[model samples]
Target chain A: MATIATTPVLPATTRTRRGHAERPSAFGTAILLLGVVYCLLPVVWVVMASTKNGSELFSTFTFAPSTHLLDNIVELTQYRGGLFWLWMLNTAIYAGVGALVSSLVSALSGYVLAKFDFPGKGVVFGILLMGVLVPSVILAIPQYFLLAQIGLTNTYWSVLLPQLISPYGIYLARIYAAAAIPTDVVEAARTEGAGELTTFFRIAIPMMAPGLVTIFLFQFVAIWNNFLLPYIMLGDDHLFPITVGLSGLLNQGATVPALYTLVITGALLSIVPLIILFLALQRFWRVDLAAGAVKA
Target chain B: MRIAFKAGALAAVAALALTTAACSSPASTGDTDGASSDSGPVNLTYWAWAPNMDKVVDIWNKSHPDITVTVNKQDGGDAAVTKLLTAIKAGSGAPDLMQAEYQKIPTLVSAGALKDLSKLGAASTKSDFTAGAWNAVTLGSSAIYAVPQDTGPMMFYYRKDVFKKLGLKAPATWDDYAKAAEVIHKADPTQYLGTFSSGDPGWFAGLTQQAGASWWSISGQSWGVDIDSAASKKVASYWGGLVQKGVIDNDPMYTPAWNAALNDGKQVGWISAVWGPGVLAGNAGKTKGDWAAATLPQWTAGANANGNWGGSSTAVTAQSEHPQQAMQFIKWLNTDPTAVKALAQIANIYPADVHATDSALTTAPDFFSDQSDFYQVAAKASAAVQPFTYGPNVNVAYSAYTDAFAKAAQAKQQSQFLSALSSMQSTTTSDLKKSGFSVK
Candidate 1:
């Protein structure tokens, strides 16, 4: 069974007839490895390229690292009175709070739409689905205009408030809540003299914690990676996220070539936190995936 | 849960505010101590994309301490324009003083985004600058919108070494230029005479402008669109013929391939503006001291006429709260010899003010190594650039025209080029009309 190479290796190894299917196919592994390399090539390039000084950046081969990483970081830190750190802090606030609130709202709404029979439930779900289809680029300018009407254009609320109503997060939450939590448990909690809200928070929420974690992670990464909304909403650079701040740096690099090294180093520094975050939250993601497999 | 989420959001906001205060508090990126000092009678925000403008602005601030002009750097041309547009539509966040490219002036003015500076004593500076530079910022001969800042009269920059080796003289007319293209390519098939990019409408507009094609003009009260004129079509066909024959390279400029081409002497010349010397040195480093500058070849024999490519003017926005102080700074920035001299040192282009050309600045660019006498030729060409008015939706028309022109340029079809020209004119006209502008 271990030597078999005729078909994809399957997890169901005890069945001899389908054992070859359980084996990982070389072609699939090659494709996935290629995907991983494709995703990481830019990260690796930034890490290595940030080590070179100004003149050496253009002169050297891209993958070759030099000894200017500390110098580059120092320059970036001194850039605009350490504004790169401000961008990092702003990004955390925008993504962290935005994801937490959005997940809470999505869980509540998704639980209601999934378990409770309410008027216009189908209409609500249809609208949520339609929201997922509408592109964010189209929404961003109009959002800017609407936010402008209330005098909140350059404020933190402008960027955070729009991202909190992520329709995709709600859609995922609904499917996950319906699959992960059983209706009998909700009825049993209600029958035990629990109110609807109490039943939801006490028992159903605990049952759906894995699903909510998945939603939170989804919303977190989405809000962190968002560029256009922040670029449009914020004029003050101090309020800018790392995406917009690095973009501003990269754009200015055309005139000032030395800023290119700063941009590379800034980019490498910006991603480390996100990698750490993904690693920290990765266990819940695995559990969610396993729960999803059982539900499937 | 809802209350907890609110608390979390509030806590995050509080932490961010603390961080912000720890690092300069609203003046993080070079506001020049306005909020802290609180001394100026008027505080004006200036949005400009030019590099090293702080020195120029700092000079002004030192002389006049009553008014403080805080500099906000925009990254590029398109982003700044988009930012301005959004700010104008939103009716807030517009900078008091912003540098607008000469071509974008009309589009911005038509949108009623810029303050009419003619009333603000803009007319007094009219005699101080060239008509080609001054006319770009003036609207309909009465209302001026911006101060003339810089000019980019097109000049022929060539590899002097390559031309000498090929026994080629600088072409004096468009006919001679076409002939030289054929000769250059026939001599060395691997190289092109020059790049004719489809992606850049500015280069095309400059050529058409030099060809005596006025793409638009104000007709009484309504705007006239004439991008499909015979003169423009003729210029298009001329480039099309060369592209079809494979004599001219169609690669876009400022890319890795174009840089390599210029560096390796694969492209013999670039018909660029006063900024060419600086850019050529910056990008094509290996070709130092090998290049020389000449005025663009005439459309008619011995005409000595040229076209302008890039220039910008500083204007006061309509949203500006303090227009008087704004104009005071603007006038001094453009007219004062001290400020202009400071600007010319690092600006890398010919100064728009006629008085700004001092002897020390004219010696030679280090990149050219004094071999070419580039500035003298560039100045002569600057005077010859015919006055042309850019249309009111200039940037919008450019994006649409670039797309259609790219298809035509790639396919090498004259009819396609003409059709694209017609469609561009029609679409721009109707779109402007739909946007409530009076179009003829």
Candidate 2:
């Protein structure tokens, strides 16, 4: 009788497990789908609007696509003798260089804090935690004042320097490093006569490759989307990033009509590189998530 | 580890050296003054928002090689002023020249951002501009602050096709305008004569100006705010009654919805300024050759009075070391026949120079090709603008107007509109006093 009861309970548990696997929460999925539609609607609108010329933009249907995308791009490219392309180049330099250096600094700092038992390390981490709570927008005016004191307010360095030390990036790196890079590897490398910098660059850095890529991608997108810092720091349009440059096109003043078509097209073109970068680096994110699962 | 420490220390030293080098470089370049006997080429930077201003400066750059001006186009009036004020407070990084609006001159002067140009031969160009335009830069004082670049004299624009279809003539008085609005709305529920734009404080100020209202005045070191004066209240109530009666739409201008309204002929008229053609052509391109310009409907019949709207002036900043050269560039930019002509043609602005109408604006804009006398009507309206004074705290007043009127417009209440004016008056006066200005 006991064996028969146990056999019935086991089959019931299996049946419940299969049911859970086969069915999803309908209400939860409806909310999530609503959120997705809300997020994607504006992007779809921009894509559709960019294809319409100035005359057809407001008069036509909101979602109806037109054939003026190429014409709009050509006009935007010809604006002020191809100044929009210069803005794109400036954005690339700022985000590309800024993210690379930021990730390197974050990796070093985070790895040392995770592995090393240095004095005042708690104080340093506490300060970093506090910094993570402070919004970056509040820092722009003060950064502008500081840069002005050094006579570097309008230069490219003014924008690059302030973004290099993101506290949140370092914190993220710390969590990632503690989980990914084992201390045993560093000690083994040291026992093999590898120098401190040599071990960090060769052993720990390689072990933390997926994580560093995550940090790099995060910083890259942040710097790319940053507007207030560069807007306040740089005075010269030649030094302006795409965000500031596109804003200038729209706010040409009360008298002149805004360059709506060019701005819309520029916005669409600006997102293409971001999409490509995401697709390229998405594999790294997958590998990072799966690494711990494989170890378990 | 020791090698790493040494490398880091060396890098720190290098960064210090670089910063010092940068600090000294700007100081040396910024020290040279045009007042000095050095005939060296002066590189002046101008912060302006007018389109194709670079082309206008190209003309000057070719002729005056000694002082080459580079135009750094900025976002419109308020944003550029905020940036300029920040730079002025920093004691560096300000452009040599800025496009100052007439209302902002008082604020800029009070902040010591603008250099008084009267001592630098700006007085000679006074006769070139209208008296009302000149009065704005001077603040009713002896000190001249800016050169008038353009003026936006308020005018009435209506769709000729729509008016003809309805068998209605253009209204010449506010009473007639109300009757026409009722008739048009009764004929078609989707159509309206105009809209009450609460988002634009400048537009409201222009309407009040036509009613002989000066919102601000200064007398012997004291400021006066009269935002809720009888004249302003009259203008507000008139617009509010129309909105409440549902004859006019209580929507803001310069929005996508309004653009659509203008395009589809739901909005049949626009109470805009001389610069209206460019806006109409850009927004309602299909409606071209079907619109005509006339003077704003009179408060009293045959009054022939008008008000000013969007316009800007060129001012030299106090931080500029090359004030002399900066003054020369602005004078040429505003008054030179070729430069003013370029401003009208390429930049598409109504030049503030009194003689600009005689020479530069002989032809009508393409949008109003049907109305050949557009500029003539504009010039007549420009000559009739009443004098208005702007206080140092116009920004506070303007923002208060947006806040109070936005709610009133939403509620569609006439009493709320009048109360909005009182709120604006109190907000402006209190802010002036809070900022340590004596408000009476």
Candidate 3:
């Protein structure tokens, strides 16, 4: 979801910055306005819909805001003794720890692949890249089978373990490593008799900090937004991530309409944390850092 | 550089082949044989996914002192089956009993995952269920695999106020319904006497079955697909004519647009299953007390025959060691008067039991103006539904029909509908055959 949501903004924001550097063009402003509206429309709908009771959701005009926002939130919180909060916490644990570990693994792997001159180095990088092309969803069922064989499924470890080896993250880290971590600096660090591990942790890691953060942000959002894996893996509601929990609630809406209100309110609440995370991570965009690395 | 990259890529692809090694190998079901410990009271694990099911489970636990069953709520519908299939293939974590839609019974039976309940006295309880519901849970002659639960008998619900203004009485047959469509459309171009949703093929199937179209059947160890039968052709033309002529509104149901249309009285009534009343009340809250229900429009003069839409049943998995206790719980849950009454509140439908005389099905909903008896009409339809079977290919059939009908709705051609039906028929046949079933 973060990947998709951020896609249009990357190029658009770049264009806007150039426009500010020069003279603002009306055409550019119009396109920016269109993009803004396109991205915000669903959020606007969720806000308006969350303010409606079950019946008013369909009967009233879509944009009309009702007075039931608080009521809807109360109902959502009360659903199964505030199970919504549990789903949120489970998601945070999965995404938070999963992304942290994934970024480290990707960084170290990518660093080694990029800097080392070893046999089968290119093959390791190629296989990791090939892994990216194979859709993640295909891996989920087979992963389930593998995990179930060892009795690891239906546990937090099930979700966390599969997500930690993100092929795309490895690919991105490889790109960042080649571009940002110059071999010269690492060679110089090694000449000082520092251990290879110390050189990586002290020099290459600090230099690759922005890139790792970028990888972390991508992975965090990917695991946070994933629905199918958790839906297939976890049977216990207590272990459900927000996506599966909300989707189950949504399906129940076919029989119980009031659940629709809860789904809308829950959706509105779910985005708040991700939005804050994005806002906080704005400095990791690394356009300046990359430019400095290229100059060096 | 480029040559090394190419060789490296080849080697990587070769190395990656290890991941596919386990694809062919299936994991054995683990140590889940919990039903073997005798002497002590039997602890049964039941998996179900209906709303308010815990309340009913509590009632069952309270009544049966000797047998205590623990309920595990799993995702319902197809996801439930996927999980069950995985667990069954693994040979572990299979619940003692599970609830699934009746159409899914054949798939589980063919996979040899479901227990044949003939050994557990399911044969004696055949008369307790609606014949159609009973037929749904059974194989060729005797093997009853699941205990029938709630049923969704097809019925017609209408906005009584809109119909009264349009001088339209409850349609007794399809001909009268079409004629009413003409009247209503001529009076107000925006108004329709009835509607047909191309997206909901189950609704079409019910209508076709009402016209005596046996699209699916089972003979001696072989399945038959007759979706393009003459009766189905008649159903297509009858509804297709109304859809083409713009007499009946073709607004798709269960969407925001459809809800607005219903609230605006764009269609005088709706033809759907017993569950339609609850769905309508949920969607059309403003138009409450202005609606009523009648039996699905008959085909023959004063004749009575209908078709079911959605319902589910409880079946014991083959993994269960205590089939007798599982059967007792299933029968009690479905047939016990108190249990059925409790279930009615949870599912909000008529239980499959024909003899459970719960007056709730007869009471007029506040949304229906207290003028029309929704559940009583549904009960009549349930009794009239012929004992028909949905084969294992029903899911594949439904998806194919969905795509085909979406085209027919857009094309607005009877030939298109026939072509779609034929395509679905062939697909269902081949799919069933591919699954190692003898399909003719």
Candidate 4:
């Protein structure tokens, strides 16, 4: 055994040095815990606060929970035949499908700018970068007028169409594609008689999958939390999202105090679906600045 | 795998097609309802803020079954105005019957968004309503715009028990009112004889109106500002002195501090409009049988002290298809004594109609206690109300005067107050001109 140990192909010195370096540093653990607590504090408060009655909401300490959660939910369900549920369904349709369609357009548009040598590519990229700074709210009134010109105001398309063009998503996709897809691999695929579209489908897309997941998540959350756009665009109550619906209930609470519980319960129900989606898809999120920096 | 994705895409396409098909059905059903493109049961949608309108709608819905009435409950004043302006710009799905507040009619009319209702059928009932109330809905001599629904008649409300304990009688003159405050404060170091809130523009307007000062005026081509008028200056100075002397507490609505003060009965009296009993009932357990009502104290003794505070009117929009049906509902809600009485049961909205004052509902005892007859007090105050012109920029003038008066009271900024008042007057005059109101 001593003679056999005389010559090992790999050196023990390098392996030992790497092993003794560190075992998950405490600083990294602390930083991650701090980040999580910062993000979840508001949500924790909302969950506890929803359980309290109106008097308890103001009288008790901020985060203390009371025994009114189920009672609040039942009262909210009885308000005008559960119109709150209609708002929830409307919000889901707006965010879920809106984000999905936006992701596809962004992915395809970004892939083109990254892989192809198109005319005026620099100018196109510059215009897209400019779009990132223009706030969505500023465009709402103008968008409303434009839609009204063709008689589309108060329609689902008025909201859904304006959100589809996400310039930031395109910018992210282009950056991810440039780093993730290897140039030599593309050349080799081409030499093997694979067409451009074929190579893109089989190779480039798979490499960009992780980055695309991050893009989809960003777009989903942005659309889910949007309120002002829908508020300005739609006039019909039946077409309102959860945010608008909850606000109407809150306004009524000013004159009638009993509606306060309904507002709180509606607010609680509104955020549950988004939280579940966030938790389930969280593992796919590559938080590293460079998700494409993997070794072949 | 590609075929499955294509199938999913096809399904989305099919869904879109179905929704498009569904939207067209409402358009086609219109012809069958005997609504010729022009004269069929015109869909007149009404937007009202008060809960009382719900009772009025139930009555109207039974009579005018042909006209489809969709009631959209909206907040009154600024919030409602914002929504209306946005809807008008959108040019579709506008409410047919819209409720406008007393002070907001001029601002709304100037925006060119309302129907010219001078020719509407409610014209004959104009004389029957209170003079001050009808004046708000009429812009000029010829352009009568809306049907008056409710009126606010200002009065002084006091805690009868608190007054008796302090051994003081309710003052009939402004001087006596001041003396009573001193006596009450001497009796209990904590309690003031009355309360005043600087933040409320409506309260400031009521004070100025009680002193016989017009907030806005139109003279040929220039507008007159009344912030510097002798009557207004006296009213502001008297209230400002009370604030400085520490005999009055300034409390806005719904604050924790305000709520606590209300429950403790630190303020023995309050001067508010016909619906102020609503405010009293809001704090039910705090002041059950302790309250009493009287006419407001006068500056020049035996003056017209009563002034309107909050009221509303209903008008049909130009876009409405069923004008007849909408008017049918509006007339019932505004002029009918039975309907008005039924509404008063649900909400404390005192009707503008003189006949409504005679209703048996007005004699109903207080729900909180049997010690007071609120409707009689409101009716007496209503009979003494004085009308003032609310120009196109009435709100702007109101804010200007309130801010100036508050500064003078809160900070002792006399020179600054005068300058601010003049500045606001000039700005309001210009704003009125831009809005096509003859500012002179």
Candidate 5:
């Protein structure tokens, strides 16, 4: 109860200390903009390249926009009764939900491991840390066999199930939990007679919210950008993620040059939501690596 | 608000649960007894990768009464193989009929993954097929795995206008071809007479077959390292000279350089397999009428006259529920003249059926102007094509050769390139021999 009263006071004092004005770092802003430009070059090329007809694509300057973007979209949409859109939807389902579940699992697992002394605690932590170093590509063959044994290969579960356990995600969450949640708060809640589950839900999760967002975004991008695992796992075209689907288009672009336009357009479209997500979530990124350090 | 967020999350989770519930469960039992509705009309599942030939399936489905074939355009060959391998490993999930490449059959068959088409009753029909194309589909003497779809008869295609401008006829031999290329390059500094992607040793393999060399033994067993062989050295030195002399516009396959050559019409001629016509058409407004066909320039006095490059086949997987139906479809697609003709028109493919039509040889289309009937030209070139024995380690070996060839081309190293190719071939041979192929 004393800590709960003081929590409101601490935030007000911190806000007052920051109320007047803070000068932005000129060099930092410039460096960040430079980084933004470096990343945006390829994306910008794809957007402009997609607009040109096959003949015009290589004929004109690489960046000079052309009139065929709408035509390319129409062609791509009609390629197989809007199968591209279906792929887009499947990818959204896979990445969006896969990341959500993975983030939740990471958060819950991390919170418990960080805040409590459970049985086999050290073993779990060590194993999860090792999992972070293990490459997903190495798991693809084994995962395929395991999934195939259960008759799960070629279905949506084939892709979704393997991606649900994010090792890096749990690692990040553990770090975040340790940094954000205070052991004293958990003890105080326990003294007030809150059950372990109740303490986790009411006290720890909210404190860990910002870190969880970072975990969610990290997992989201990892799953979204992933090509090899889904490419290896999902046999059905209808179940393909955008990366796999776009690469398929590019392969045909070898024989069918007309497909180049569709591939470029699809590539451009795939990255749009990702860029938006990053921009929207920038506020959660740590400004200083030491900002979360605690006082003794 | 907190309750609302949790409720929203719960609802999303519930939606996922609902969707997963709706997904078709992995078949609880193998569709083995041929049990999926002979009563309500048989639904045959066929898988292919042709983005343009979905209509061929629809046309076939509309034409057939007893069986309705639903063709699903799967991903590329590698993806399809990976899927099929997984399914084969599962012992149940493979499609009823699948379009596999002729080159892939050797590996697939050796793996014991495909249902023997000979068992499915296509043995005699497959025998009546063109020997070279059919050989590409067969795995050794016993197991006939796939039925040939189209024969990729290697032919030399030249830009008649460009050839005329350079005052040269289409070269009749490899030496002549190289000399003519040099002449053309000399005549126009900017225009090279020919270009080939060295990165794809498939053409080299075909050339080797033409020059009486086999890269691997069929039983997945032994390999012949022709890289250091007299004919192979000649082949490498000849092509290398063209690149070194700067007479050939070197365009690696699927690169911007290759695409630019097509768009600009810079290369005078290209030697490609029969399937190259479709590749030309697929490029649409590019390369239209700028090309004409001739027999693949042979190595003068070479043991073999011509050889196949790229072709594909259809086969029944071991997991197929209805092997008979699968064979029927493959037989109709490959050996039936009428079906082959229909597919040719729709897909612009030259049929694998040796007897499909002599007209397939001579029907002069305006696209090539006086390129004559493509079928007849291809038929002539199809002769002297010895069987290409694809080693079981063909995929890995080819990748090795490709890597070596790339480094050689870029770095100008010849001995290293030959050594790399030899090692790759020997490894493949050894792997195949271990896998039970009879390699001499």
Candidate 6:
């Protein structure tokens, strides 16, 4: 049965690949190349700009590389006694812990909604869908007020707790759970004397591993790049994420010159972790695509 | 199924309980009283953007162990004020003190974000600052809202090499300034004397202040806005005429293009402030010794009138639990001889204290190393600044100026510039009325 399920997916994948290989449209290729350049030019500009010192930044050619990348990094690191690193660490904690906990919650709620029959389930899911429709930016001010009332506005929890319940993540998980976890498999685990929690942790989770990875990466990148929530919630520079910290460096008021070189260099360094994360988790995405094809 | 439902419900309740528990514990620990009991050491947080301010505060922290202050560096004026107002409205998380721009004082005070320093015995420091600087914080009232930290007495910065090559001297009058603008632009089409920056309403405000125009004034409980007064119109049309004739550039300052213009000497002059040297040295390092500072050109020849461009004051927040301690730190930060010297040397600000000249400012800033009497020119200009009052709707007026004059500057029309002033006046007055402040 497993062989039968897997065999058809192979031909479907190879056939699409062969079709693309045979008739590659020039127009389509050119459009995609345009998209690639559009996406990559700013990144290239950043990489080139980061290498220049303060004077060379404006004087030299826009794309020309210089020798001050290391020096710029040193200056940025030394700024206010390595405050850049503190912001980096703070960002990591917010994104890492926030995404991890959020994904787990998403998984639990998603599984229960997908596999069980319960009263008021539709209402719960509908409210979540409504939440997904509401932009998080609109909620930031209200969330700030809520956090302020509780005296948590400047704390890490102010940023963290508001992000713990991502409706879109839960919605994605629900859809993934319904598709990935077969009802028969859940029943078989129950018949084998597994409790619901044990069944979830053992059989269902392994089956939903690829989907959970997608949800985790989504939440991770979303929280990592989030600016407004943290900017509004936190006041202490020590607790600020990388986005807000770098912004402060650029806007040092009218009297002082902005640290343009440091900001550019900091921006370059900030993206390194995100790139590394994408590269590491990219294989799971490929696996997910193939798994979806087989299941279908 | 029932058990699963029960488990999920229990988890939700537990999560909520944990949040409230975490929140309530911190709430209880915070000091709620307005009075400074001073039972123990006071920990004050200050939001400021001046560079190396932490080092300046370090001296105070070392000497005054009982009331240690932490400086949380923030972004420049508008962002800091916006954050402060948000914190004030939220009823929590505001710092003990904030660095407020001179114009922002009225807005902050009207919002009740600031404590009246007059109540905190800050009135005694009045002699330390110039009348113009002092009046900005007091807003023509007895309530002292802030203590002036730095003053940006307006000055003209020109490239000495470029001026000499063009056979021009620093303009002594607005007419001479206009003639020089034409001469430079006629000599080199790529160059102009200076740009009309619609983006900076404060810079425009300063120019008008030099022309003896006060945009807003308080009488009784009402505000009288005269944004389009004769003095302001004279200042506006003067620049507009030059921009229309294509003798002056309409591009704004503090941009990358402007920085490049300063570096390569494509732009010969800048109408900047006392702290212009730091910006020049940072942006145009190649043209360091080539620049010179002079007083702003007068409307009438030999007149010594000037205006302020950018400056800030240290203000204690109304939400501060220990107002007395916060005021003490602010007083020391601005008026103390040791602290003022540190502000000049370490923070590189043009200290607002009149006594800053006697000891701290013995030498010129590095960019003006050749101009030995730089601060003397700045001091003269500082003393000459005419008092100008800012209203609670200065932000609305400023943004209106940007919108209206940006079009005027773009069209390069003298008429539009004059019309823009009227628009700013109307917008400002209407906004004041809408915000429940009586306007005359």
Of the true interface contacts, what fraction does each candidate have?
Answer: 0.14, 0.59, 0.26, 0.09, 0.35, 0.76
Q: Of the candidates numbered 3 and 5, which has the greater DockQ value? A: 3
How far residue B50's Cα lies from its native spot in candidate 1, in Å, is 1.5
Of 2 and 6, the candidate ranking higher by TM-score: 6
- lDDT value, residue A184 of candidate 1: 90
Better structure of 1 and 5 per DockQ: 5
Ranking by lDDT: 6, 2, 1, 3, 5, 4
| Per-residue lDDT over A189-294 for candidate 6, one digit per residue giving the tens place of the 0 to 100 score | 9999999999999988888888889888988998998989988887778999999999888887667787899999999999999999989998886676566556
Q: TM-score for every candidate vs. truth?
A: 0.80, 0.90, 0.86, 0.79, 0.84, 0.92
Q: Model 3 - which docking category? A: acceptable
Q: Per-residue lDDT for B240-309 in model 4, tens only?
A: 6666676665444444445445456876777776666665654433576787877788777876567777
List the candidate 6 regions with Cα displacement exceeding 4 Å.
A1-23, A287-296, B1-36
lDDT of 2 by residue, A90-200 (tens): 999999999999999999999999889989999999999999999898999888878777778789999999999989889877887788888898899999999999998
Between candidates 2 and 4, name the one with more favorable TM-score: 2
The candidate that wins on DockQ is 6
User: Over 4 Å off in model 1, which ranges?
Assistant: A1-24, A27-93, A104-130, A170-209, A236-239, A245-272, A293-296, B1-40, B62-65, B347-349, B413-420, B433-439
TM-score (C-alpha, index-matched) for candidate 1: 0.80
For candidate 3, lDDT tens digit of each residue in B1-440? 23422232222212112111121112111113324443458878777777767778889888886688877666656777888877666555577898878778766665456776775688888888866787788754466779998877888888777778877798898888888889888988888776668766777887888888877777654567888889888898787777778787665666667766776677667887777767777667777778888898888869998987767899988666666778889988998878887777655656888875453344554566476555667667888886566766677988888887777767776677677778888888887666555556
> Which portions of model 5 show Cα errors greater than 4 Å?
A1-37, A178-204, A253-258, A285-296, B1-32, B35-45, B63-70, B90-93, B218-230, B282-287, B301-304, B358-372, B411-424, B430-440
Backbone clash pairs for candidate 2 read none
Model 5 error, position B51 (Å): 3.0
Q: What ranges in model 2 sit over 4 Å off? A: A1-35, A289-296, B1-32
Residue-wise lDDT of candidate 3 within A14-48, one digit each (tens)? Answer: 86886689987889999999999999999999999
Tens-place lDDT digits, model 2, residues B1-440: 23422222232223222322333244335445444624888889998888778998999999998999999877788878988877766767789899999999877776667776776799999989999999998787777779999999999999888889889999999998898899888999899989999888999999999999999987665778899999999999999999989998999988778887898899999998999999888888878888999999989998988899989999988777777788889999999999999999988889999999999999999999878898999999999999999987789999999999999998999999999999999999888776666666
Which scores better on DockQ, 1 or 4?
Answer: 1
Kindly indicate the candidate among 1 and 5 with the higher lDDT.
1
Docking class of 2: acceptable
Residue pairs that clash (backbone atoms under 3 angstroms), model 6? none
> Per-residue lDDT tens digits of candidate 1, residues B1-440?
23322232232223222222332222222234434433547778888767767667888788777898887767666677788878877767778898888888876665456776765688889887998888788755566779988777888888777778888888888888888889889989977879777666777888888888877787555667888888888888888778878888876666556765776778878877777777776556777878888888887897877788877899987677666678889899888787777767765546788876554256667777665466667678878888687876787678877788878878876677778788888888876676555666
DockQ of each: 0.14, 0.47, 0.27, 0.12, 0.23, 0.58
